[model samples]
Target: MLVIPAIDLKDGMVVRLYKGEMNSAKVYGEPFEFARAFENYGAKWIHIVDLNGAFAGIPKNIEQIKKIRESCNLKIELGGGIRDEDTIKQYLSLGIDRLILGSIALKNPTFVIEMAKKYPIAVGIDAKNGNVSIDGWANTDSTSAISLASKFKGSKIETIICTDINKDGTGNGINLDFTKQIAQASEIPTIASGGFRSDDELEMMLSDKYISGVIVGKAFYEGWINLRDIFVKYQA
Candidate 1:
C-alpha cells in the first residue's frame, strides 16, 4: 500500500483541523514546502484539500495549489470546493494527477459517473456515525457510506477515499472495518484516511488487501510517524 501525505490548505497555509472543524485548525507552513518535503521523503502521491473552498462551493486556493504543482513532481490528488466542469478542467490543466469529488458525488451521482468516464476521478466519502457528510462535514446526508459507495459500482472511479470523521485528526487509529466495507461496496480501490497514529496501525492497514493506500495527516505532521523511515521500510 502507498503511504500518501495529506496537506490540508486553509487560507493558503498548510493546516490540520481537529475532526474537520475549521475553527480548530492549526497552520503548519507554506504548502509548497510541505509538498516538496513529502516528495523528498519519497512519497509517491500527495493528497490536498482546499478547506476554504470546501465550504464555499468554489475553489479558494487555486494559486497556492498551482504553485505546489509547479514546484513538485509528486502526483497530486485534490479535493474540496470543486463543483463544476470548468474547475475540474482547470485543475487537470494545471497538471493534477487526480480529482476527488465529495459533496457532488453525494448530491449528484450522475455527474460523478459521467466525470469518471473522462478523467481519473476519485470519490471521497466522509462519514460520521455511518452516514455520509457533505459541505466539509458540516451537514449529514441521509445516506450511509456503504450505500453511497454502492452507487459507484462498475464506474470508472479510480479510487474511493473513505475518511472517518470521528477519528480524523484525533490520532485514534482508523475505522478499518468500515473502510474495508466501503472498498467492498464501491468495488473500487480505496484509500483509508484519518486517524493514523502509529507505524503498527499503518502496517496493519497496509496488510488489508482491500485498501490501495493510506492518507496520513496530523500523525505525520505532528511527528507521530516518521515519513523517511516509513518510506525506507514500506515503499522502499
Candidate 2:
C-alpha cells in the first residue's frame, strides 16, 4: 500500500476542507514545495485536487499544478475541474501521471470509459450515506457508490477512489466497510480517500487485499500520522 500525500489547491494556496465544504478551507501554503516535501518523505505518488476547479468547472490552479510537476518527481494523479478531452490532454502533456474523473464520471460514464481506453484514468466515487455526490460534493445523486463503481468494472481505468464525505477531514478514522464494499462491487483496484487519521487504520488497510492504496490529507497535515515514520515503515 502507498502512503500517498495530498495537496488540495485553491487560488494557488494549499488547503484542506471539512467534508467538502468550500468555505472550510484551511490554507497551508503553496503546493509545489509541499509536493517536493512529500517526494522527500519517500512518497511515490501525490494526490492533488483543485478545489477551485471542482466547484467552478474551470482550471483555476493550473499554474500552481504546473509548478508541482516541475518541482517533483513523484508520480502525480490530479483531479478536480477536469471535464473534457482537452483538459485531460493538457494535464497529461504537462506530465501528470494520471487523471481522476469525478463529476464528469457521474454525468457521462461512457465518455470516461472511452477515454480510459487510451489514457491513464481513475474515477472518484465520493459518497455520503452510500449515495454518490457530484459537482464537487455540492450535489447528491440517487446512485449508490457501489453502483457507480460497478459501472467501471472492466474498464481500462486505473482505480476508483472511494471517499466517505461525512468522515472526510474529520481526522477520525477511515470508513473501512464502505471502501471494502466499493472495491468488491467494482472488482477494480481501489484507493481509499479521506479520514485516514491513524496508524492502526493504516495497518488494517494495508492487509486488505481489496485496497490498493490510500489518499492521506487532513491526517498528515494535522500531524495525526507522522509521514516520515509511516513512509519508512510502508514504502519499503
Candidate 3:
C-alpha cells in the first residue's frame, strides 16, 4: 500500500488534532515547506485538510493550498469545509487530485450519490466514533460509519479514508478490525488514517493487498517513522 503523508492546516499553520478536537491540536512547521518535504521524499500524493474551515464550512486555507499546487507537480487530495457542488468544482478546477467528504457525506446522502457520479476520483469518507460526523467532526450524527460507506456502493468513489477518532494522533495503532470491515463493506479501497506508531504497523497493513494506502501525520512529523527508510523498505 502507498503511504500518504498528512498535512492538516489550521489557520494556515500545519497541525494535528487528536480525535478531531480543535483544542488538542499541535502545530508543526510551514505547510508549504512540509508539502515540499513530502515530495522530496518521493511522495506522489499529499493529503491536506483545513481544520478550521471544516468546522466553519468555508475554505480557510485556499491561499496555502494554491501555493502547494503551483509549487509542485505532486498530486494532492484535500478535504475540510467541502459541502456542495460549487466548492467541489472550485477545488477540482484548481487541480486537487481527490476531495474528501466528511460531515457532508453523512448528512447529505443524496448529494453524495449525485457528486460521486458528477466527479470521478474526487470523493472520500472520514467517520468518527463508528458514526458519521459533520461540520468538520464537530458534530457526530447517529448514522453508522459502515452504513455511510455503503451509500457509495454504486458510485465512482475510488477510496475511503477511515479514521478512528479516538486513536487519531494518539500513536496507539490503527483500528484494524474496523478498517477491514469498512473496506469489505464498501468493497472500495480504503486509506487508513490515525494512530500509527511504527513502521511495523505500516508494514503489516502493506502486507494486506486490499488496503490502498495509509495517511501518516504525527508519526512522520515527530520522527516516529522515517519517510525515506519506510519508502525504501516498502519499495523493496
Candidate 4:
C-alpha cells in the first residue's frame, strides 16, 4: 500500500482538523514547504484536502494547490468543494493526478459517473459509525458507507477514500474492521484514512489485500510517525 502524506489546507496554510471540524483545525505550515518535505521523504503520492472549500462548497485554495503542483513531482489527489465538471476540468488541467468527490458522490452520483468516464476520479466516503457524512462531515446521510460504496461497483471510480470520522486526528489507530468491510462491499481498491497511530497498524493495513493505500495526517505532522522510516519499512 502507498504511504501517502496528507496536506489539509485551510486559508492557504497546511492544517489538520479534528474530526473534520472546521473550527478545530491546527495549522501546520506552508503548503509548498510540506509538499517539498513529503517528496524528500519518499512520498510518491500526496493527498490534499481543501478544508475551507469543503465547508464553503467551492474551492478556496487553488493558488496554494497550484504552487504545490509546481513545487514537487509527487502525484497529488485533491478533494473538497469540487462539485462540478468545470472545476474538475480546471483542477486536472492544473496537474492534479486525481480528484476526489465527497458531497457530490452522495448527492449527485450520476454526475460522479459522468466525470469518472472522463477523468481520474475517486469517491471520498466519510463515515461516522458506518453512516456516510457529507458537506465536510457537517451533516449525516441515511445511507451507510458500504451501501454507498457498493453503488459504485461498476462505475469508473479509480479508488475509494474511506475515512472514519470518529478515529480521525485522534491517534487512536485505524478502524480495520470498518475499512475492511467497505473494501469488501465495494470491491474497490480502498485507501484507508483517519486515526493512523503506529507502524504496526500501517503494516496491518498493507497486509490486507483489499487496502490499496493509506493517507497519514496528524501522525506524520506531529512526529508520531516518520515518513522516511515508514517508506523504508513498507517500501510500498
lDDT of each: 0.94, 0.91, 0.82, 0.91
lDDT of 1 by residue, 92-181 (tens): 999999999999999998999999999989999999999999998899988999999999999999999999999999999988998999
Better of 3 and 4 by TM-score: 4
The all-Cα superposition gives candidate 4 an RMSD in Å to the true structure of: 0.9
lDDT of 2 at 177: 90
Q: Judging by TM-score, tell me the better candidate of 1 and 3.
A: 1
Per-residue lDDT tens digits of candidate 4, residues 4-57? 899999999999988888889898889999999988888899999998899888
Model 2 agreement with the true structure over 140-224: per-residue lDDT tens digits: 9999998998998888998989899999999878898999999999898889987888889888998999999989998888877
Model 3 alpha-carbon drift over 4 Å, by segment: 121-124
What CA RMSD would you report for each candidate?
A: 0.7, 0.8, 1.5, 0.9
Off by over 4 Å in 4: none
Instruction: Spell out the clash pairs found in candidate 4.
Output: none
Off by over 4 Å in 1: none
lDDT leader: 1
